[model samples]
Target: MEFGILSLIPPIIMLVLVLLTRQVLLSLGAGIVVGAFMLNSFDIVPSFNEIWKSFSQIFYVEGDLQLGSIQLLSFLILLGITTAFMTASGGSSAFGEWAIQRIRTRKGAQTMPGILGLIIFIDDYFNSLAVGQVARPLTDRYKVSRAKLAYIIDSTSAPITVVSPISSWGAYIIGLIGTIIAAQEITGYGELEAFLRMIPMNFYVFGSIFLVFLTIYRKFDIGAMRKHEEKAQNTGELVDPSKEVPGDLNNEFKATQGGKIYHLIIPILVLIVATVTTMFITGIQGTPAEEEVSILSIFANTNVNRSLFFGGLFAALSGLVLYMFLQGSKSSTGKVVLEGIKAMLPAIYILVLAWMIGTIIGSMGTGEYLADRVKEANISPTFLPFMMFIVAGFMAFATGTSWGTFGIMLPIAGEIAATLDVAMFLPSLAAVLAGSVFGDHCSPISDTTILSSTGAGSNHIDHVMTQLPYALIGALAASVGYVIFGFTTSTILSLVVTLVIVLVVVLLFQPKQNSIEK
Candidate 1:
């Protein structure tokens, strides 16, 4: 029963296979099968049986986990439908025309996704898919690399969610911290307060956001990204050299004769309003007013997956209605909606495989095993925050889920923090949050990463390769920043140093070139 180091084997195998093979589904499926074998104590028959059972349970079981997965899948399906409808109705074309008149340069093209990513802080899933669908046309017009568009979408999603106070990520984090505080018997500690204090210390998220702007403003591109961008500029190929994305994806949405920008604006507004209202209503459905008075409390308790499903459905329906009126033909509406859902089938498949692998790893206890190694190691209190950051990053990178990393590492970090100076608590907490995002950002197996690739229509491997360098730089800067925070216990000083490190590193490594123009 005690797998010990064997618990880590599945994730390690998955990571190796991904890097070597660049085949995500095969790699994930193989990793899950290997983990199943381990779970069945190396009995080939039972392992094979277990794999099928797990797959069935993941899709059909009447449990929260199964429901959650279904909710996510539904959201993705609806997102695809909404996007397709927007294109079919000529909403995307209208927006493209409007944006073209305003956005006249490469930086402007790049900035739009980043801005949208930041604005859509309700959920990273929504941010990733929506940004890609909305911005792909604009980026293509300027010949921005699909890799770069992916980078922008990827950078903004997890980082912004982790930092925003009213997102699904924020709620999950608060719940994790609350449980830790309760177990530690730490009195008078406010989860929201502690989270607020750690915001400035979340170096990687802040650094990544800042790096996005700095890279854009200074016309800076380095490493694989620089090469990809140059290729896009010179040859107008926005994807990697070896990849072949269908031109229909970019050109299929012919503009309607008189489609207005309102066609796009109305549905998106409805989606946002419906989501927020649903969250509040869901939050208040069962709780007494006295207990759930605060908006934060309401948000923290709401079923985010369900809300997302409903929101996406509403948005898709709204889009359908708009298209019906525009086309005045039910068959045209039905065909376009089906096309949108079909477009997302590949992404949905990847998502299902990723979740299956995550489930298998969870059963193997990959994250806890990694945490145990870190906890058992003799680490000093002063250096614990920095060390925890690395440990959390590795665990997340291997498992491809920062949420899983948080569930495993935060309790351990909280227990350790209780024994250290009071000032050390926030830095340790921030380290875990920042490092988890870092790992998720760089991980090829991460759902958000896959969504980013799907959204930008980039080759998944190419997106991973190009974005990894930027993520690493931000990680390195955050690691150094945590060390400074550990020593000084000054959030402001630590934050300033981290920003300086990121800016300096970016400027130093930047490729010198004339300002980019399409």
Candidate 2:
């Protein structure tokens, strides 16, 4: 069952195909076939049969891997509907008009998406879609490149969620920690406290946020991003025309003449409230009414899929009602909602493909193979955190799933850290979290990355290309920070050193202000 070197072939093939062809769907499909072939001992005919068999059973109640792929697809569909409703009702325009008065400069316009993305910390999916829908108009008005907008959305989504203690990412990581603690039988350790200790040690998220700010304030652009920004400024083309542009919700909606800002604000508020409230309700679904529970317990126990689905559905329905009121036409509102769902059909296909590939990768024991390779390296305890960061990043980049990387790496890191002399556990654990985000940020097949492009209406490959250098910068700085923490074990010193490194890198790559045409 252990495929060893063969396990690495699928992801490598997928990445190569994506870079060469810039076709996500084709590349993912090819990867799945290749993985299936490998699983079937190199029988090409059976590979085709095996892939369909496994993919169809993705939602089957046979394994713990049933991630409710349909539920996630529905959540995305609902979010798309809400986004369409907002745009169609002119709520987005109203919000943009309201925001433009307070945020006049291009930098502020570009920076606000990051700020918005940061605060929408409940789920990365919501953050990516909502931030893009709200900020695209503002950014376009200022000639900010869609690539940059996509970068901000993608960066802030996973990075912010990884560090947020209340998010789905947080719950997953905490669950991983709980399993580790229980399996290792490590006494005197609480999952909450352990996760809290890793917060400052999560250097990648901090470093990524800092890099976004640097880009916003200093106008630093390197590699493809610089060219994208320059083209946007010179031609006023917010998106790169050389690449295939993804479909957006804009064309589906006819913005009303005098829509109020409440149309936008109220729906978003309802969505957030619904998501949070549903999380609590689901968290206590099985508990007795007399039983007292903590918020953390609720978060830990909540059904994330149901919460996101209901939250997005409620918001979409609310937006539909608001649009109906504003336009005074039920048919028109219904039409916009349908069109919104249509707009997201491509994204839905991409999400489904990503999930399909993810399942094949897991079935191949790809994570286990990669982790075993790292373990065989016989890395020293001091270098474990740094090495684990690289390992986790590579695993995530290859697999295009940070959660999968966490599943594969966290327990290994925790088990190894348990035997260490000092408190290396936190740093090692943080390394896994940071590295996972770094890889996911750069990966073309990543769901968040794809959704960011879809939301910003940018070219998928362009977003990946422009964002790669920035993500690499953050990853490199975080790697160095992990190394420092591995040695010094001082959170403050490590962060200071990491931030300084990031600043220096930014300054080195900082584009000339005059060249940017402020």
Q: Give one digit per residue, the lDDT tens place, for model 2 in 1-518.
A: 88887888988999899889878789888998888888888887888878876677757646555665667778778887887777777787888888889997999998889899899887787688778877887898788888999998998989999988888788778878888888777776688788888888888899999999898889887888888888899888877555555546545446887677888888788888898889889877834467667665676677877887888899989998888777443337668878777877877777777878887888888889889887667678888889989999988888888988898899888888887643787788889999999999888778889889887878888899899998998988988888888788789998888889999998876777755466
Q: What is residue 146's positional error in candidate 2, in angstroms?
A: 2.0
Each model's C-alpha lDDT? 0.81, 0.82
Q: Model 1, 1-518: lDDT tens per residue?
A: 77888888888887788789977777788888999999998899999887887777767766445787788888877877887777777777788788889999878999999999999897787788777877887888888889899899999999999988788789779878878778877776688887887788898999999988887777667777888888899888887555533112444445565677777877777777787788888876734666845666776777777877888899999988888788533236677777777777767777777777787888887787888888788777788789888998988888899888888888888888887655577678888998899999878779889888888878777788888988998988888888887788778888899899999987787677755553
Residue pairs clashing in model 2 are: none
Which residue pairs clash within candidate 1?
A: none
**Which candidate gets the maximum lDDT versus the true structure?**
2
lDDT of 2 at 90: 77
Which TM-score value belongs to model 1? 0.93
Clashes of each: 0, 0
Off by over 4 Å in 2: 59-67, 185-189, 241-247, 250-253, 286-292, 327-331, 514-516
